[model samples]
Every structure is written in C-alpha cells, then in structure tokens.
Target: MPTPGFPPSTLDAGGGPIWISELASDDPNHAVHVVRDLEPADALEALGAKPRLFRPCELPRSKPDKWTSLPAAALGIEPGEVPPG
Candidate 1:
C-alpha cells in the first residue's frame, strides 16, 4: 500500500516523495550521489556551485536517467547505464 505524502509504487518502487534539484556529478559515467537528508548549503557544496536561482517543482516519479538522456540521444551520444538506486 502507498503511504500518504508518497509516490505510488508503480511510479517509484522506493515509494517515497520524489524531489527535483539541479544535481551534479564528478564522474561522467555515474549519477550524482548526495545524501537525501542534506541541508541546502551542503547540496550546493556537493555540486561545487555558488548560489543560483531555481524554482522548485515536482513531477511524477519515473526513471529519470531515461528521459534526462534524451538530448544526448538526439545528438547520437549513447545513453550511459544507470544502476538501480
């Protein structure tokens, strides 16, 4: 059963509310890895970025790597493998 304030299992097997952010990774072959319970400042440090403007929004939970790679795919860049989170 799905919990209140959480995404359904069909959308996200983890069955938790999904969050969106501007994530950054040092490794080109891997997804950005940041602890879920990070403070906003900590998250910014992880991205090696200074404060920037962003509007928070939510979307249906889905395999993000698939869609996030669309632009690369259009440019004929092979999609990288995304390990199960």
Candidate 2:
C-alpha cells in the first residue's frame, strides 16, 4: 500500500516511542517531519491520528537546509586532509 505523502521508511509496528523523519521524502533537503501526538483539547488523548496520513513538510526556505548542510569542515579535518589508513 502506497502512503499518500509519507514515505515507506516511516512505517513501523507502532505502540512505542514515536519517531519522525523525512530522509526519504521528495526534495529531502527541504523536507521535515512533524510529530503531533497530542491534542490540546485533551491532553490525555493520543491525538488519534495516523502518521502516514500526515503531510510532509515542504515549506519554502533558504538554500542548504539542515538535512543537506553537513560540511566536511565541521569534522575537524583540513581542506586537503585525507583519512588515515
């Protein structure tokens, strides 16, 4: 079964710690996962919603979003430094 906007990677057995990801979404660089598991009206409720039915975060923003902003320089390696064998 194909989930509308959610990717297959979000599918899990359910009933445990909640997790959200957008690595498999289209335009993943701009994609994000929002987990809303509580309803303000009823704090005790489980939101009674399905994650697969949730929409993918596609808001327009500046270039190089968090997911695609990982640079090698952040690893404390010099520009021309190669990995030790």
Candidate 3:
C-alpha cells in the first residue's frame, strides 16, 4: 500500500478517458490504476478481471525461434496449455 502522506499527482485533462486507460495499462483492476474516467472502467471491473500486464507495443509474450512464428493473440501460452476459465 502506498503511504498516506504520499502526494497525489495531478492529471492533465486533454484526451478522452481512453488515453488515461491506456496509460493505466487499460486495466482498471490493477493496483497502479490511474483513473480519469470512472463510468466505463467501473463496468468492466464489475465483470471480474485479473490485473494483467499490458504491452503497448503489441509484442508476443514469448520469444520465437528460427522455425516457429506465433501470433500475438496466443499470449506465448500454448492453446491446450491453459485450462478454460
């Protein structure tokens, strides 16, 4: 937890809430969430989501070798490797 004496950083309001969400890793459930908009973010959070690390560069989660090229959506985890939620 952050110390209560820590000062709150002020936000510059310019772009839409989308921009704030992007900077906050687009995941409101994260501990480091910086919320500029509450409506939409609240809806998504009510649905239950884990705080996931965001990759702004859209890179795949795993390193690919000489013979294999993987899609970004695969998340570096094999299809059958993870059980259904």
- Candidate 3's displacement at residue 61, Å, is 15
In model 2, where is the ten-residue run with the lowest total lDDT? 15-24
Could you say which candidate leads in TM-score?
1
The most accurate candidate by lDDT is 1
TM-score, per-candidate, Cα-based: 0.29, 0.18, 0.22
Cα deviation in Å at residue 79, candidate 3? 2.1
lDDT score for residue 84 of model 2: 42
Give the residue spans of candidate 2 off by over 4 A: 1-71
Per-residue CA lDDT of model 1 for 1-85, tens digit only, reads: 6364444533333543333221122124546444557786678667885555322334333333554543343343345654222
Better of 2 and 3 by lDDT: 3
Please give the ranking of all candidate structures by lDDT, highest first, separated by commas.
1, 3, 2
Count clashing residue pairs in model 1.
Answer: 0
Report the C-alpha displacement of residue 34, candidate 3, in angstroms.
19
The TM-score obtained by model 2 is 0.18
Candidate 2 structure quality by residue, lDDT tens digits, 43-65: 32354545444432342323244
lDDT of 3: 0.40
Q: Give candidate 3 misplaced runs (Cα > 4 Å).
A: 1-43, 52-74, 83-85
Clashes of each: 0, 0, 0
CA-lDDT, candidates in order: 0.43, 0.37, 0.40
